[model samples]
Target: MRARNQLLDTDEPGRTVLTRHLPLPALHPVDYARGHAQFEARSDQRRRIVGWLDARLAEHPAEAPLSVLSVGCGTGAVDAPLAAAAAGRAVPGAVVRWTGIDPHGPSAAAFDAAVRHAAPDAEVVARACTFEALDTSDRFDVVTFVHSLYYVPDVLAALRRAVAMLSPGGRLLVLHAPLGALNELAATLAPETDGHPQWWSDTVIAELAGMGLRVHVEELDAEVDLTGCDSADRALLDFTVQAELTDEARPAVLEALRAAARPGGGLRLPHPVTAFTVRPR
Candidate 1:
């Protein structure tokens, strides 16, 4: 059985506190760097997604070039690798056009800089706007939301927008680690903390099916092993924990993480991601 922290009585009604002070750990700069580094490291996964899209495009006898739009494309992580893969392809005179969109203030400039640094020749266009904010006149062969769907206030609406932007036979992909089992575990361990919203899985599939889109959902175990990572690589973990937990519960969560860490060792957390591929009917 895991050691449990004793709960303390608080004068405030319906409130309880821990006896010990639990400070959230600070993640190392290296950890912050790893988020960006991991994107580049996952070239094979990017290629697989791009290849899948290419195959789908090939299935149709479309004479025009393939166009791909990546929604919520943060820092051009997915876009850069995808462009590289398309450029390396042997498609005879096949032009691959790419568009990256994000509502993040710095996304456009940051993505442009990253793409120029990585794949200068790639046809990449980026906009600092959300799917809902974008003009509906544009359509694409492939549209993807990579780990950014959760941030949307109305996931169903955002998904609908994505599907609407797909050209005939076009594919819409949603890639993120579902917070199902992990969320349950976290809630069980710490009920005070609000777990991730339940709508992520429920609405995405339902909306896709209702719109007459053929949906393919796959659960992929892409765990990030932080055991060998240094202190610099743990900052995101710390910030994430602190950001998610309330002040009263923050310390306990940090303490829990501290307990998970081995002596003179690093920590490992499960990162199970899910990918949904929806093709027009």
Candidate 2:
């Protein structure tokens, strides 16, 4: 089954996001980590999410523990730090039940270790599976999909499922990369998507609006340090395009980076992400 595709392109202002196939094969988890590290302003994103989670914590006290479901929690690099932060925020006897699921077993295993180490008091279940594979009827106080929705088989279905899993007054938080200049070039150079659409934030937001849910949109700004970026920079390059580039694709990628070059003697690709916070019944 093709299993994955989304609505036509939704252009952001001042940038033309090419609606061709995204790079093939996607980035390996490790490469994704390295490339994401190049993002100059990720800490801002982390803080915003952690604050949102902290608010979720405030909704109840020790008597009523917060339930959190994290979809596509890979390696817990972004999540574990905040998980540790949550540990400190919890009242002396407060409890948090955290469930994280990712298809990559190794990454999930890593997440298990990190969260267990960081949030010792919280009940942690790190499973290696898709959102659908983790069978549970329990409602969550907060559910998040951080930059992982683009790879899901069905973004809208996953979003819907997350909302359904919410407890009353619960919030669903999603952070996804919006269509931008750097991604525009990558999309143009990449090979077949194998039927998987690299969904942008607008598509997901539109879906949520179609469902009649109120979504609070937050625009985030960041930069990818593409200084000296070249085809040989395999980890960052592969991550930038979400796939291994061809000989033909490399020069064009480099040219695109240069075109967006920073005034200071290197390339700084403007990478923006959008946060969608939805509170449903």
Leading candidate by lDDT:
2
List model 1 lDDT by residue over 87-162, tens digit each: 5552555666778887764766677777656655557788888766777587888888876676576676777778
Model 2 segments more than 4 A misplaced: 1-63, 191-194
TM-score per candidate: 0.68, 0.81
Query: Model-by-model lDDT, in order?
Result: 0.57, 0.70
Model 1: weakest 10-residue lDDT segment is 185-194
Q: How many residue pairs clash in each candidate at the backbone level?
A: 7, 0
Cα lDDT tens digits, model 2, 1-281, are 22121322435454333333343455665766666555424235555555655564555555556678888887787667667766666777667878889987888998889888888888899889987778888898888888778767677788888888899888898888777776665455444344665677877977887777878898767666666557345666766766765556566557656766556766766776787888873
